[model samples]
Target: MTLETEFRTRAFEDVRRALLERREIALLDVREEDPHARSHPLFAANLPLSKLELEVPLRLPRRSVPIVVLDDGEGLAQRAALRFTELGYTDVALLAGGVRGWAAAGGELFQDVNAPSKAFGELVESERHTPALDAQEVQALLASDANMVVFDARRFDEYQTMNIPGSISVPGAELVLRAQQLAPDPTTHIIVNCAGRTRSIIGTQSLINAGVPNPVTALRNGTIGWTLAGLELAHGSTRRFSPATDGAVRVAAAAAARAVADRAEVGRTTRDEARRWADEAVRTIYRFDVRTPHEYESSHVPGFRSAPGGQLVQETDMFAPVRGARVILADSDGVRANMTASWLAQMNVEVYVIDGLTPADFTEEGVAPPARNAVTPPASDEISPAELSALLQSPGTVVLDFTASANYVKQHIPGAWWTLRAQLADALPKLPPAQRYVVTCWTSALARFAAPELAELTGKPVQVLTGGTSAWLAAGLPLETGETQLASPRIDRYRRPYEGTDNAREAMNAYLEWEYGLVAQLSRDGTHGFHVI
Candidate 1:
């Protein structure tokens, strides 16, 4: 038997009562962006109908929580309610009469919720959001405070050309990642500004989303607003340097490198040491010539794989998770691989930069890495196609093709997985270990960087498809490009199993609420076995 459910019509006052009574409620305003930005309720979160599916879930406490959806006289609530039900969300209720109804009932509306209203109001009152600062206010603040930090969110190169005086340069994407680095004190109030409003809004919102505790408010209208107020914007072509490291960082790193090099009893490896590693074992001392996957396929070191440098560095754990594992990083320019090795060294991993000049004439110090030879392989070291074919046929083989997204789509080898060097850190945990791997790129340098990393992901016997796909074609081997094949069990995305620790904080939040009886408990009496420290 099915029970017919009655629809409940919720009023603005009734919703307010629910909030005051401490009932779970999400007051979502469904409106287009321009209207929402112009005027919205103080606490109302704008999850526009177009982007509601993506934004609502991110904002809500839970799917089951009561969600009051409303729109501005557009008669869109019913459609939104049905969409929510179709998307498998329960407990979504319609707000009667929309924003107009709430306004008729004398409900208060707010401009923005992502920003702290009191601070923003003060900024607006002071006209700090305008382009120009009044001479009096500027003098008073300057006299009262000398430590206030002002930041300009623009490209560094652009800042060098022209920027406001005493403003620091920080790119938009760099804000969240570098917030703490820029301001160590939580009490430090950050004033973010851009040449325009969009970047300021987005940049300020990013800080808020990243959970920055410091108070942040954007300058309204940005530098343009400042200019309208008759404020002077500075112009300069010279570079501006931030604070110095006091010789501590460089000095400490040098000391550490010297100590480690001494303890290993390995000075910069001589040509002999480098060659010895290459010839030591049939598969030991695997070399990767890091480059684009396409180049690697062309031809390379007989045993080298194509591993890109960026991916190799990002997925160091996936590439070579083993502690004290030996790895050689090779790149055409040799600078990229060597630079990557320097960073890996800081992590205490054993990685050497190899300038695989060629099969013959491996050079010593003072010799420029062989320039890319058009007749042979470009100055970069790479694996041979024949060796790559051999490695692929071997049981327990892992093959990687590190090429750009566009190139990989055009053509690639069968059973070869295209991996972006940047995403390696995030992608490796899910890879399989049943087989050894041969990584390839457009050149051997990248393979040198990426191959060992593939080995580290599975801790299995591995080798590089030296010389990349080129080596395979050179050896008259078959290639499967542009196949768009499904990822095999060996290289498909891997999902991490949920662990108790992963939800420890969430469990604790639930426990506290349950203890206080502020919010209903998910289960009775410590079934979750959660404790807070």
Candidate 2:
């Protein structure tokens, strides 16, 4: 039977009703990231078809959970449904007419990633009356030698890109744990900011919730507000919170975070409990290490992925795509995990923190590898960088790079066409016909995963560039810059207005204006199950 006949289909209103009823539905946009970012339903998670097999286990652990996949009428939803069936997904359906159908049905389409969380943050500010200071007020404070510190509650990379002149990089989850150390004086005021609203509001409230003695406030609408006010942002600043030397400070921070977690009713679990959760066949469980990347890289619990506490709170949907999944957070320092778990609980996740696990138990190094069965492309389908270089010298071989667009623009193999794995069906017919095709990305995982698909699509001999571009560079091969050979448009990644040193003022203003309208959109959509506590 055809895929359309094999799987059920859900209309936009059916999906909308499921969301409003708080049912466990994974409304997925099975398109490439760029297209998914351009427009989607508020709760629709972007689980690109290319990464479906690898991510589905983690993101949707319950095999029987209802899944409604959609694309912008690119024939992806049908293919995704078939793949879902193959992967043992018991309840799979396609969104009727895809994303266009949702729009046609009067569903509000939101741009950018994590719209639900961002909108929820805006709602929190409106409902909770989160305190704030406008850019001018913050600027005047910066001018004086005020006994206050501004914490940039964004990722370190984001903070380093652009920030308030004197702000230190303390991500949202870290605010509760590190705020006391950053501002020991009870009378000192604390200011928090992010590229936009969510992190700033969440971070400020986190500090307030933890009962930090210092008065806390979000820096209005964050760096966007600062820039809109014609204020300057410092670039490439490295001011981050220093490690606490005082044992007493660590103890106090942990106590404060625990108190907040208790109030939030976040549960405490043991390693034994985690093992049991992992074994449960009917439920989804996410194991995360809520510490700094460096710390997580140095030593982390086995089977626990690294998701720093602050970024976890800011991007919960990305981490735990399954809304009702159980998340167990781990941290060598108890404070970060508890603080992060508190927010996750408020966000309506069933979250827990692993307690009584020692550093010895966290003996694993670097990020945890994907599960063994996630990707194991056949050995015969792989070619080394040197082999690929030799093959490229021949005429009928086409190279398709599947790395992110930003990485592709930075550097790639000469004469390589950057393509999205999910868009290969649409992209292949436009490409020059070739007898042999090579697939690659930064690492070979995505390339390997796409090899069979590319081969099937073109009816040609396709091989993965073993170890990908990184391996090619290590092999001393020449590299090319810019968007050189393109079989596809650079729509695989969204260009964030707050990124880099240079961004158009108009885009920044428009982005802020869009964020401001999100609360109203939430009301209109009537699907987000967000509650401000």
Candidate 3:
């Protein structure tokens, strides 16, 4: 089915129909996160053109699967289509009107990242009536010596950022597996909180669905609601979940997770069966290790990428963009994978958990490599960090840092100008003309891959800084900071409304309001094959 051809355009109606009918489709947004966050279709996944080559094989495995590239009139769709062709993606097309056009065509646009998963979380709460306690109620519990434990169902780093006092970091997928160990007393009340809503709702429901003996409730609106209620947050909390669990507890957790998965109609597959599924050329299959990153790094099944169960459930669109793709989750512990698969099944995905695996079966250790490699810079164009530092001393040397905008602001070469490879052509016009053009990124991988394009666009001498800014820092070289001399707009990352303490009340309220209405929006879309099993 090598149907690769000149990229064509697709109207919103055509894309909508494909989605409603459950046809395999990857409606990709090829813009930066900031721009992508502002608005996109309900199911559109962000695979920015800057990282397309690096992430395409992982996210969109089936070359022949229907793909519709879109952008906000940044002239990016055509470039992305060309890159897809170069990368052997056979079935690629462009959205007829892009993001704005979708709105013009009456297609609903959603703000924020991970809208699909977030909306699914909302649907689960609506259908399951997942129990929840407001901030004030939880605050009172904290004030008193209540026999309750608040578990922050977010990444540990997030918990460390701002969390409810006395809350322990027990990420969503770990809730059922580690809850018993953390709160050995069955009567201890369990409260889960995330930055906003999705993880908290999912985490609390996970324990409830698993038939946990304790009362489980979500902190409604999570940390946002806590803040809105004039509550103080604990920062830099290093609380971690207790790892030790008795055999009886593990047995009960496995049975509970299995039961929940069975109720959700999640498929069970053996190692051989999952391998067969992955080998099938007709369908796209994403294999992931749903355990914690530390566990994954210690040992994981071969060919499985590390995507923490909680993040995977919250960011399905990012991990597996193909709406109707098959997903296989692996975990040595029966609890995490099954629990993650249950939610994915409810999200209308063909999800399966690999069963009957042991520690010895997971022979692979260390982080799994990326699915695809980008173009390599020629040796002739590679400049060592030492050489580049000396070049910076002379005039007419202009360095463009193509790292993420936030990273560029945090640190870069002293006189480096920040730019994006996706918008380098536009950014070049604003940058100073120079005898030599030096490009660098955080690790230099992106910059190296971008050398050819910059060389072609500029028709000038181009060189890539070896090891990028990281190498410069490693060399103990002086570096500059702040968002100075920016050649491009800082739109690489979206500032989530629920993060940090500086979010405006209006934005936080509006975000919660948006989530509140996701069920309705999902209904109007007439797609999202979601169910609350």
Candidate 1 lDDT, 139-229, residue by residue in tens: 3444577545556665566566555566677655345434555666877766666653434544564455345676776665455555445
List pairs with backbone clashes in candidate 2: 173-310
Per-residue lDDT of 353 in model 3: 92
* Tens digits of lDDT, candidate 2, 1-533: 45556677899878877766656778888887778888998878889887777677667767888889888888888888898887778899989888889989999999888887888788888888999999999999989988889999998998999999989999776777677777889999999999888899989988887788899989997898898899999999999987553678778888888888888889999998897888875667788998889888999888888898888877777887765568899987778999888877877678899989886898789877876335355454788998888888978989999888889989999999988787788788777779899889998777877888887777889888878899999999999999787777877667787664375677788788888898999888877666656
Better of 2 and 3 by TM-score: 3
TM per candidate: 0.33, 0.92, 0.96
- Cα-based lDDT at residue 405, candidate 2: 83
Task: Give the TM-score comparing model 2 with the true structure, all chains together.
Answer: 0.92
Count of clashes in candidate 1: 71
Candidate 3, residues 1-533: lDDT per residue as tens digits? Answer: 23244568999899989887778899999999989998999899999998876677778877888899999897888888987887778888999989999999989888889999999999989998999999999989988989999999999998999999989999888999999988889899999999899999999999989988999999999999988898899999999886667889899999999999999999989998888877776888899999999989988888899999999999999999998788999998799999999999988888999989987789989999766433434454889899998988889889989888889889999989998888887898898878888889998878877788888888888899888899999999998889888988888898877654375687899889989999998888777888897
CA lDDT for candidate 2: 0.84
Alpha-carbon runs more than 4 Å astray in model 1:
1-7, 112-149, 153-166, 170-225, 232-533
TM-score: model 1 vs. ground truth: 0.33
Stretch of 10 with least lDDT, candidate 1: 524-533
